[model samples]
Target: MARFTLLGTATIPGKGTELRLLQRNDEFSIKIAGSTGELMNSRLHGSEDALATLACERISELPSPRVLIGGLGMGFTLAAALKSLGSDAQVTVAELVPEVESWNRGPLGGAAGYPLEDPRARVHIGDVVELIRQSPAAFDAILLDVDNGPEGLTRKENDWLYTSAGIHAAQAALTPDGVLAYWSAGQDPAFTERLKRAGLSVEPVTVRAHRPGKGARHVIWLAW
Candidate 1:
């Protein structure tokens, strides 16, 4: 067995929370302090890639499609989105934690092929919810993988993103037939109902953590 070594720790603003980064041989993993579960693992990111591919694939033919991706956990999601997008397409990735961005551009970049360097990809170092509240009908698709799910384990502020109000903001930010996708470690029945109550169609997809369809199952909610 490869022993895990603590590489470093980064502070997550506003909650006095610090995320732990661990390295085991060539792999990297991140987790919140005192949490049993890992926030993200470099080796397992099929669902994250699916989050972007599934959303962008639907709007591929649309000219200059704009996408808003929340959480830069790793660049896997962004990389997948960029692959499916056209030349004129734009993808805005909003990451609340600055260190997370650095991690992507630094150690984690090698794993996902440095997506931030893509001209079509832009990184915003702030809360994604704020961006949603500020921009109306600005995106063709909104993808979020913040925390573990709608119910946050990293930051309580993230709770707003899943509430009826946040859903309204995301819905308003999207263009006609625009899709709002959320990635969660598990299922949230109440969140599904909330999406329906907001007048949007929801498709719940279960995907594997690893590509050839292996590893743990995760839920991705694609609402339009």
Candidate 2:
């Protein structure tokens, strides 16, 4: 059996604790035991395609829009967003772990083709939540794939992002008609309600992509 080798580690502000990047042959993994959930290659808990689809769907509506992506896991979501958005669209990816960002730029670049280096992309080595909280209604769409789900898979601090306050903060960061999308491993009715309670229109979408031709199913919560 093949095993993943420990590549490196890094710490980010606001996200808490440290993050480790692992690599096994061509596959990559990221684990932030105290921050966002564990990400194995492109399969995050269970839903990477679902989240990417949701982000792409939201970005597809705009022409040359500015977008914000919370996570850079294998660059799957980021690449999908880039593909869905127009040529003039600009994407800002905020990755908490510097090593994860480096992995994206280094060995894993071939898997996702280093989309972060696209002229339209601006990679930021910081916390996505803080970036959203600091930016004021600047993005046309904000795709959050930071944690496993609102329930969280890594740290308890991530729970704040799913709370009403977090939802409200996300809403405040979006443009008047902007979309806020969240990728979860599975469905959480309570978190769905929280989005609605945040005074935003919510749409729950399901997608499957783990198997080779999109056969695995996952849930995505789209709130605007």
Candidate 3:
């Protein structure tokens, strides 16, 4: 069986440790040592498209909207957001890993399609949670693909993002009628309830990929 090789490792501020970049033949992935979640993917088929679709749908209403995306990953969500929004739209991407950003600029550039070069895009190398906390009704749309799901795959600190307090903070950071979209690897009924508890109008959208035009199945929580 084929396996991934260690590409490199780097420490990120606020994230508290070194993160590893891995490659398997043509594919790339990022994981924190001793952590369970896979961060970025060069395969183009993992978490990117789903996040892109979610952002696109939310930004359809406004021209030149300001969007905030949590987690840069391989830049798939950022690329998709740029493609979907108008030229005037601005996207702020918050990524906790500095090496992931470097990888995207280096070997992962082609796979991500160089989203950072876009004039409307800005990259923040820090915790997305801090950004959300500081931002108050600032973004037209907030798209979160930070962890594997509500259960969290990497750092345990990520649990706050799925909690009632975190949901409230996210809601406070959104403009009135703005959309909050979250991508999960699988469904979580309890989290859906938590969204409702946060006073959001919640909708669960299930999508599949790897089959014809669509392959793997993904669940997206659309809340406002």
TM-score of each: 0.96, 0.85, 0.88
lDDT of 1 at 219: 93
Ranking by TM-score: 1, 3, 2
lDDT of 1 by residue, 1-224 (tens): 99889877888878889898888887989988888888889999999999998999889999899999999887999999999998999999999889888888887788899999999999999989899989999999999988889889889999999999999999999999689999999888999999999999999999999875698999999999
Alpha-carbon shift of residue 130 in model 1 (angstroms) = 0.6
C-alpha lDDT of residue 173 in model 3: 95
Model 2, 99-186: lDDT tens digits are: 7778888877777777888888888887777898899988888888877788766556667888888888888888887888888777
lDDT score of residue 120 within candidate 2: 87
Worst 10 residues of 1 by lDDT: 99-108
**Ranking 1 against 3 by TM-score, winner:** 1
Please give the lDDT score at residue 54 for candidate 2: 61
TM-score computed on alpha carbons, candidate 2: 0.85
Q: With candidate 2 superimposed using the best TM-score fit, by how many Å does residue 198's alpha carbon deviate from the native?
A: 2.0
